[model samples]
Target: LTPELKCDRPDLRGNLVIKEKAITYQAGKEAVTQLQFERAVSCFSKAITLQPDQLQTQFYVERAEVYLQLCDFNSAALDYKHACYLEPQTKTHFHRLAFIYYLQGQCLCDQGMFLDALESFAKATELKPNFKPYHMRLACLTALGRYSDCIRLVTNWLKIDPPSADLFTLRARLYHQINQAALCYYDLKAALRLNPSCADALSLLEEMKEAAECSRQQAVSKAVEGELTNALSKITTAVEKNPEKAQYYLFGIIYRRLKDFIAAIEDLVLAVELCDAVAECSEREKPDNSNSLEEDAQAQLVLTYNDFAVHCFSQGFYSEAIKLLTKAIHEQRDESGLFINRGCFLKQEEWLFALADYQQAEELDPQNRSIWFRLALIHNTMGLHSFGKNFQDAADKFSLAIKYKPGVAQYYGNRAKAHTRMHRMEEAKLDALSALILGSTNDELLRLFPGCSLSDVISSATAQTVKAQLMEQTQMWKLAGRPVTEAVRKVLHQRQSLYRTGPRLSPLRLADASEAALCAAKHPYAWRNFRGLGLNC
Candidate 1:
């Protein structure tokens, strides 16, 4: 019969002489079995109308199933909800209702109606509390960035079911999204423990390790090139990819190098916390296998302490810098660089302590040029502060510097100055000549003796050659009032004329009196000539 005719004859009797609704319900089930969803829906609707007060819960459930097949989600949901109300105590009824809501949620999710889909899936989970509905709800929550909700839901579900690898992996990924990296790693490790062959968990772990290594290499390269901003960017990406101890340690180091002390401290502290967490997690593992992570973390912690001390020193916080360095030294006594760096800071305020640190560094690394150089510089500076009384000390330090780095001209020049201050004229002259031979400037020689002529200080042959070069280059007789020295004039000439390329030399490079006096007595009009030429000197 046609659907219209069947609807018009709804009052017809059944085989038991009961209401026509039972016969119509049977026909709807037959239509559903045949996959004629529209015909089944129409027949179920007519049966429900014919026996509105006496309708069985099966009528609504059957129609809901047909509506689901037809992809009419709203109708299916309404019928399933009604079936739930009619058979509230039946497990089968609620399970069927949950299935319909789950299907509706899937359709909504496909349509990009995430909030609606989330509601549907949540209701399904609430009704059934099954794995499929719970998983679907978590997917919806995750897609919506509802991390806290997803975590709570998964955590509650875990209480009901024994731990599964896939479920743990899902929760771990959710924790990762929320930046709870330690917790994420904890869950991932747990997942691995449950099922060692879980490919997805293993792949994620490997990716994090690779990303951390790549970031560390890139950061180091950029920092070495003095590209601090790019280095920070690389380390930041690394931290995002893997919020592990090594990555945080490297990030802290980069921040310290960039002189961002506050950020460096925060990252370093976090790194230590993560290290502790990792240690706690791994405590149960085999003792004979060794923990490389723990060793690396401890090393990084010491390095971070040393680097932070350097940062403090750069900002002139000497006491704090020394304290931090002391802590680092206490932790790792074999680090020679730390001793040298701490000595540098202590040298400013505590000479004795500085000496002790330098001596320690020397013992640790006898052949290190930098340690020797720093020791010599500190001694030289201290001696200079005592006027001529400390000339022997200054000279001794300069000698040590020369012994370690024999080719350095500055060391010879510094020693010559110390010898001059002590009135050891012959020794001073010899050292001065050695400095000159080693490429020390004539200006340094002139500074050592103010009133003496270049010939009085050195051989006339050397004096005359330097004098001739000065006269040709500077015309130094220009300044009428100054005492003239040929070597000084040569230095002045280079500064005032030769080194100046264009219209004028920078004010900073202007020739001073000692340099300008080499030929000042021989060419008195040179100053006027210079003025007429628009030269500032």
Candidate 2:
């Protein structure tokens, strides 16, 4: 009977069923030999159905192979799993299952199902912890961006197996992805030492070195151009690639240039930490070589703190800036610039603290006129805020300022105001006259006096008269129900000016009368009504 007919009749005859299934299995084998995978699959399915309990594990495996050839990975995996179940103790069966799982994972990877593929390959490795399957699992993990998992897997595998160049290379690549460049370099070196002919390891090592150099050069170029953000990115890459203390220092420099004081401070702190660690390690290994890195790191730390303080000041973070400056001053006690900066920040809301800082700065550099001037200004401001309550202190500060820089007229004028507030008329006059001789204005002098000159009084009176006249005219226009147009306002303004300068005549001058006549002439009826009312013409 034909293979199809035999498969269709599984119970044709109990005595002949076994022989019939054997014939069907032979037909499936022949189909497979001819590479007709679909026909082979159909025949195999029928053979298994004919005598399900009698089927050998080889039967399932052969059919699974056919399924795989057809690229039906899911079906192939199932068939291979069934083979493994059928012959649980057979090593070949488990190996075949693992191979099928590996193939399934590759298919999943091609379809961009990285997570699923990772599971599949992981299962394959679990089923057969062989070289190829383990490596495949690592590759799948890498594709999934699970570098940590890959590293852990490789590390565990290395503990179990003898170290090989290929495994070392794989672990090195995993380290590279996570920015553990030192570990990556160690692995690459181990890989090359094991197999001196490993082209990939050598190439990777060279590439890392070249990448670090290129990054350093590009960062320097960007920094020279003041492209701070771009420089930061390049330096960051360099740090990730090499992570030397010097690279960290450069990263901090870039951050400082960007005015990211907080980030800069953090990076510099990290650099110092790393440097200390290195120094400790070196001392343990060779004590004579320890001081260089520590010394350089200490210097850089002080500079970093100073730069961080400046940025904090610019951003108006006075408390933080003062803290950073204090840290710098602690490290470099004689830095007048640091003391000055801290004093400037303190002057905003902490005058006493600011005064102390300026005093320290003055002791350090007594000839700095700018420092004296700042002290004078701060004292004057403080006196103003405490006017009549702290006049002596204000006068003392102004005198100190003039003592340092005797030619400044502003110091004398400010001192004169302070004395006037204290009722020291003689001292106030002397100071005011000195300020006037040194180019202070009369207005500045008048501020100290209780009364102005007669001419000044007369000018003030004239202004008041003009202001009253304008108001009266505006009120009169509103009472008369007139719109008070621009021409009428101009005439009113001229009338006020005339009253101010000319002799008093009926409380309105001849110029005002002529202006009124002009306005009345514009409306003859209004003028006639005015005369009828017995008003002055």
Candidate 3:
């Protein structure tokens, strides 16, 4: 129990343990013969701990072979290094050690841990200065973007080994990454001499053949500088070099800028087809919305179709414009803007189709106020055509529109017409009055009261003037005090909601001395400068 102290002198060794060490060594040799690697390693380790051979390398070599059987590479490598040290003439032991390091480097590289892989590879290269380890280390350096290190490694490799076509070509690429074009060219040329049919070298040579570059990137720069013709020329050469999906898309963009709609449409359509084909082959992974090539191409196509359709509409080709928009709608059904635009064209003579389009648009974007307003317009127009049969639907749609965007005077004006058609006089008067006060140029109201200006309506003498004017036109319709005053109060309340003590504040004050028919009012053109609402027909 003295903790088994080791004797520094060989003569001081205990006799019983010295024989046991020999026995352990013999047992290890027997375990190896029987292929029991774990037991062999255990026995050999104990033998070495008891009586390690310093002069003779047999002890390390035997344990190293057992470690190899167990695939314990690190331990096997350490044992072989000791063997190499004891017998400096045995080159195989050094090779075995380097091979173990190489295997470790390969394993780390496969796991994408490039930095660790580089360390292992560097150790392998230092042990055995050969092309294989050098090349492996170069790969790790390249992966880590240590291009300068890779160049130095390759340079060292070139000095040691005979000329290799692959090595030269690879070094050329490393030079290229660091933007050393002259050095890259020299390496590529050297590679060509070793093997004239080297494909990679030949390809790189062809890319550098174009003067000032035929890359699509160059074309993009030209396009940005507003040189469409020159940009088109560059992109044409790029397309010839590589007719990829992105190339066709760039071609489409250039054509669009040139206002050559026919060619633009063709190229974009091809881009969509090519992108879809690639997606299909790759099992159609969900694309990121912002950067998806297919989405961008299709979106551009929709816009082009919209502009072309509008142009056709202006040229009085209504049917052709409708067909174009119909194609656009088919292309991008989720686009609520497309449906609303198409409905505007159909509103001319094809009322039912317009109604269907607006309904579909509503389903796609239920919260969009433009869709709501378009629906209201279609319904009101239909009610007018059918003699007030759809006035109630028209009123409801306008209310929905107003609920989302409460300050649009056009919405209230149209709703007032619907309410008047439905014989709801109270609602009609409130809406009509609100519409005029909020700056609606209600054409029907204008036709009814031709002499009443916007200034006259908002001025202090508005009450008496409106009553006298309305009575002069239709003496039978009696003007009331309470409803007219309440309508004015509601308009002021709305004005307060929009502007706080600003130039937009309403000028009219409520003296509760009002008796005027709202139908006697005209378009409020004076306040039109406040805000303009975007309403599509």
Local distance difference test values of all predictions, in order: 0.69, 0.71, 0.70
Instruction: Give the Å error, residue 493, model 1.
Output: 51
**How well is each residue in 420-463 modelled by candidate 1, as lDDT tens digits?**
88888766766666566555676867656568655565554654
Descending-TM-score candidate ranking? 2, 1, 3
Steric overlap count per candidate? 4, 0, 0
Model 3: colliding residue pairs: none
Q: 376, model 1: CA deviation in Å?
A: 17
lDDT of 3 by residue, 450-483 (tens): 5866665545354345445433423222221113
Candidate 1 global Cα RMSD: 19.3
Which 10-residue span in candidate 1 carries the lowest summed lDDT?
Answer: 528-537
Top lDDT model: 2
Instruction: Using TM-score as the measure, name the better of candidate 1 and candidate 2.
Output: 2
For model 3, the local distance difference test gives: 0.70
